[model samples]
Target chain A: MYPRAFDYLVPRTREEALEVLAERGSEVKVLAGGQSLIPMMKLRFASPTTLVDINRLPGLDAIDAVNGHVRIQALVRHNDIIRSDVVRAENHLMTSTAPWVADPLVRNRGTVCGSVAHHDPEGDWASVMLALGAEVVAESRDGGTRVIPIEDFLVDMFTTALEPTELLTEIRVPRYERGGGNYQKLERKVGDYATVGVATHLELDEAGVITKAGIALTSVYVRNLKVTEAEALLVGRAPSAELFGEAAAIAAAACDPTSDIRGSAEYKRNIVRVFTERSLAESASIAQGS
Target chain B: MEINVTVNGTPHTADVEPRMLLVDFIRSTIGLTGTHIGCDTTSCGVCTVLVDGTPMKTCTMFAVQADGRSLTTVEGLKRNGELHPIQAAFKEAHGLQCGFCTPAMMLVGSALIEENPDPSEEEVRWAISGNLCRCTGYMNIVKAIQLAAQNSTTGGTAE
Candidate 1:
């Protein structure tokens, strides 16, 4: 399957790429790792007339923990996250989820930020980002930089609030001194999309009380759903199986999954509840260790 | 667009359409047919090749993306006009039956053994997880990779 002929523009610099995006707007698609775009193009599911390959642009591939945020640049691939000591030291959710993004070959090319931008409901990054309260940094020629929260940035399945003339440049995950995050995914097999995925994050105050909480579900909703009610239920409470169970029940009840080959809606929702509880427990345990 | 790529130590300058996949370029343009395309979609890693020493699914990558980059196809496995340690190990362990996925498997295996001189079975399995062997179960393939890792005195290089 070959993609339709399109003008491939490899811009030399970030400014040049931004200029192209400003000129073409919706007509041009920003090509980062091309792991997702190329496949969609080949399937003819997406047929953008032009593609501005941003791979040649410099300084867009750093994973740095600075200013209380772990800044993951656009070009930082999944394997990069797996190999990054900074990520390992700063964010446990991303570290646990990086190796599970896809198979090794796909990881060698697929970027985490690109995955977040793509915003596929089955994609794992957004749920992790949502659970961590990460922010998306979109850059444009005229608007400068607009940092949109992940919840606002992700509009729907394969949809984002990013303007056509804007490019997603970075994802900033807040750094927590005594925090833990975990990604729980149930897939049919290795390299397959998740049947049900739950990302949970917890930040504890020195007094063993939950100061911040994030819980998001993947492949169980029309979009990656952040369970705000459940998160509200977790904050200010101590880490306990009973507390986590209540939050998990709320999350499962909150998500709307459809019946398909992966499983029945009931089964997926049940898995969501179970995985959410397990991930929260695991995360709480890890946080307690710190 | 014109792409300058070094494949198997030989540089080739060619004009290719932006939509032309790297697998098509290697197999059809450069006439190296060792890299098979089992499933055109990224699912099957049969079209796997080392793009600058990184195993990538050529079917998923554009030929134009290979511009000014080096690639290692299955044809380049022979270092000194002899079989690569991976190839010899595959033969020794009877790793293949139909031999459809051999080239991609060996390339992934060589890359794995290169990084880790001694790999556990789990690691070897994980490294080749992207590849699929339909002819036989992965036991022999895993064993073959582990054997190749041990036989190679200088890590992945047989010589």
Candidate 2:
């Protein structure tokens, strides 16, 4: 199906794109990889009046480690993250989650920033970003740039803290000194959204005790569910199956999933509990190895 | 509204509406109908094409987005009337039954072999995971891709 008629703006630079966004506001949509936005437009679920194509804008595709964070630019595609040795080294959750974002075809064109900015609760990137304590960067013609914590950035389903006048330029994931992470997703088939997704990050100190922990859920809540209660419970403790099971129980209780064709609500919550425990166990092993 | 795209080694410039999808532009405007559109919502990868050598779903991408870019459709797999290795291997392995998804399957398979000359069966399956084939139960297709990968001496896209 063809999308509704709209004006297409090929912005040659970041400044030009921001100018159009600042002026057109909600009317103009920023087209990054077009993996999600274009499909939504074709379905008429989202029909913006104009699209500011940012693909031509140079220098927004780099993935770099800067200031103790890995900055993924606006144009960094999902496949780019999958192939990045830096991401593999710096953020294990991101690298582990990269291959599972859609498929190889979609990953070639879908941007990490676009997926995170789109903020679909079913999207795996946001949960991973949340698990890594990622930051979002927005820019406009008038306002310079604002850094938003991932928690505040994702306000609701397909909704974000971003103003209509602003464009999401980048996402910054903190570079941990020693951590291991894993993303466990349950999908019926390839290219399907996650039924129950769990992203776990465990950072251990020199003594192998947990220094920091991050656990987030996907497709189980109104938004990406960051299990702060579970995270807190693991921070002062060491990696153990029993401790992970306790945290997993808290995560299962925290999630709000409704019954659908995927499974009954009870089954989904059980999967959440099981997946949380499994992912945390895997993450702890990797952390101990590191 | 004019976009310049190189398809199948030929540069074509056209003035198209912004809503025109790349699949439509290739089939309708460029007159290359080998790339079929199965599910326009990007579910079935029958409309898969190479945008600057990376496989992407053309049905979800706009023609304007292909401006100043290169695309490789199924038609590009053949060079000088010779069938691409993947195409020949598909025939030998009986990889196709209905032939509705043949063009895309060949294109994706050829592209995968180009990237990894010796792709494992799992890698080949993962590479074509976006594409859905209702025929052959994917066993013969996997064999076809492995056949093509083993037979090719040089990394060939036949482009």
Cα-based lDDT at residue A147, candidate 1 = 95
- Tens-place lDDT digits, model 2, residues A17-49: 888888899898889988889989988999999
- Please state what fraction of the native interface contacts candidate 1 reproduces: 0.80
lDDT of 2 by residue, B23-75 (tens): 99999999999989998888999998898988888998988889889999888
- Model 2 reaches what TM-score against the true structure? 0.97
lDDT of each: 0.92, 0.90
* Window of ten residues with lowest summed lDDT in model 1 chain A: A184-193
TM-score of each: 0.98, 0.97
- Candidate 2 error regions (>4 Å): B154-159
Question: Clashes in each model (backbone N, CA, C under 3 Å)?
Answer: 0, 0
Write the residue-wise lDDT of candidate 1 on A98-146 in tens digits: 8788789999988998899999999999999999999999999999999
Tell me candidate 2's fraction of native contacts, as a decimal between 0 and 1. Answer: 0.93
